[model samples]
Target: MLSVRDLWRRHRRKVFISVGVLGSGYLLYKLYGAHRRRLDALERELAIQRESEELMKVQLSQIMQAHFENIQTISDVMTLPHAMHNLSCRVAEELDLSQLLERLLQGKGQPSTLTQSEKLNLWERLKILSFTRMALSVWATTMLSLYTKVQVNILGRHLYIDTARRFESSSTTESGDLVDKEDQQKFLGTVDFLCQHGMPPLISDMEAATQEALKGKQLSHFFNSTALHETIMQILIIFMSQGSPHSWIKYVMPEDSATSRIDDPAPSDVTEFEQLMTEARAVLLSAEFGSILEICMKVVVNAVVEQMGAKFRGGSIAMGLPLARVLPQVAQMCPLLLEEPSKNQFIRIIKCIPEVEPFFTRLYANMPSAY
Candidate 1:
């Protein structure tokens, strides 16, 4: 070692270099530690986010599955077979053709402002009219029943989709009771409308059509199955065409005090309900629906014709006509009465709407096997 002053002057540069190196190393270590800590925090946050996403997925899946089950249950609840059986029974009771015929014959000579041939013709025409009216009643009932089933299926699916979407976006979980209460009320309202408003008016319309078609026709003219079929088909087509699809909304979703609230400005489901109604109207106007309606009309018309032919063949009535010729003509008229190009377009469009395809399948499956 040299003297103190001499040593300090010589080592000062080395000391300053060593100190600077140590300080820089310490800073680098601290910065590395901080980066590692930040990365760890980020990893933890990412794990939490992934867990949350998985939870959300499970919840959404559960919600959708529940909705699907609900839709199936709804379909079972609105069974068309049960409804049709009930309707047929009620109609048979209300329109007893045998009793009506007996009554008509009982008053045969009671006083008429017409000749004997005229009275006989009048009685025959009335008999035919009664049969036509009965057939129309059955047709109207079948149509309305089919409509109710379709409406319920479409609206029920719509309601489930809407509820699922809502539940997905919301943080709060769904309450089963609340959803059931709302859905039940809406569906019940549809039933009420069908019974109280829908069937009565539709039946009345069909009855009016029968009256208009057979107003002045004689019994022989009425027996011209080709002309009769064409006339009835035209009336049916006009009846179907007269109303806008929107006119059916009331029957599908009847208003009820239960669905409304006095405190709230508007129901949360109003917009969704309207959207569903729009979709339903679209389905109604779709070609698929038209094809179904056409098929149903054919079924009803054929059944009526078959029944009439059977009655005629069995000589259930005293008409003097030969059954062999009349029955052949009637059988020939059993083919579809109307065909329109627009119905094809509707069918094509309906096939593309996958969401509604299930409904169509269900409807077609539920139709009478003869169809």
Candidate 2:
């Protein structure tokens, strides 16, 4: 019904509308792509920020750890003087020199066999040492009286060594004849009491006894008797028992490696000392005192080698404080204690595995044969 020119115009109008719509659509698509790119950039920036935050957290943690270590170091240094002074006073007060000296000088040649003059000199020396020890005991007791209470009641407390012996015996019995669970519990309770209560006071007394011993004139002579020397060693071990297996290791013998002279004449004395040291270590292991055992063992090894003139292998004390071999098991039992020195020692001990491996391997290999 329309003319040709009208038709052409309408057609042209439709074409133009279509072209404009297409152009708008393409522009919108481009804008969407740009928006997507911007979003991705923002996400990347966020990710980077998160990564930076994590790095900062890690750095902060390291800073805190270092700060804590610094604090602990400062605290330890500040406390050192107090610890030293207390040790000196206690050492001076507790050792009795005269009685120890007399015991040292006793059990000699018969009066008839000895010249009268030599006998008199011996008697005089013994008397002088005795007098000196007594004087020191009196002085120390007086000086420390205000601070330390002499609990005679504690002295009356005795260990049921029989119970300990019985428990040991029971462990050896045939499986069928083994002690009942109830009996085992009772024995354990007794041991706990002795360890927790009995031993502490006993240790205190032992310290006091040693102070009495060291108070005598001619302190060197007091160390001469094997019996007296043994008693002193035993007392020292007991004093060390306070911190438990850990304390045993912590003790730094007044003697250091630079000065390894036993003025005491009995060369055999070292054997006895080593035996006691080994026994203390064995007890610690059997008790399963955790990482404290390892730390204590290291302390003991250091003291014996450096202070007590024991021996050494590698740079470490030769006495068996085998950290590498013992630490993994200890860490398993007490992971909480594994950090810093313990961790470092654990690593060192691991490195020493090649050196100590033969000893352990041989031990394990021999076990079946022993059975």
Predicted structure with the largest TM-score when compared to the true one: 1
Per-residue accuracy of model 1 over 1-371 as CA lDDT, tens digit each: 56887988999899899999999999999999999999999999999989987887787667656765565455435433334444445444443455544555556645454567756765554544453444444344444544555655555555445555765577346555423545444543443444445555555555566656556655544244445455556556655554674343343344342343323424676643444344444555456666666666655555555555455554422243432234334332222111121232222333344544565566433421111
What is candidate 1's local distance difference test score? 0.50
Sequence-dependent TM-score of model 2 = 0.33
- How high is the CA lDDT of each candidate model? 0.50, 0.34
Q: Estimate each model's TM-score.
A: 0.55, 0.33
RMSD of each: 9.6, 23.0
Any idea what lDDT model 2 has?
0.34
Off by over 4 Å in 1: 1-48, 78-86, 93-95, 103-176, 180-186, 213-218, 221-232, 242-371
Residue 99 Cα positional deviation in candidate 1, in Å, after optimal superposition: 2.9
Backbone Cα, N, C clashes tallied per candidate: 2, 18
lDDT of 2 by residue, 1-371 (tens): 47877887879888888999999999999999999999999999999989976875565456444543443343234322233234334433433334433433453534454566665555444443332332222222222211111111111110122223434454424343122334322322221222233333433554454554444423234221232324334444444454544333222211121121223312553443332223223322333323332333333223222322122223222233332222122112211112222233332343253433343233223311121
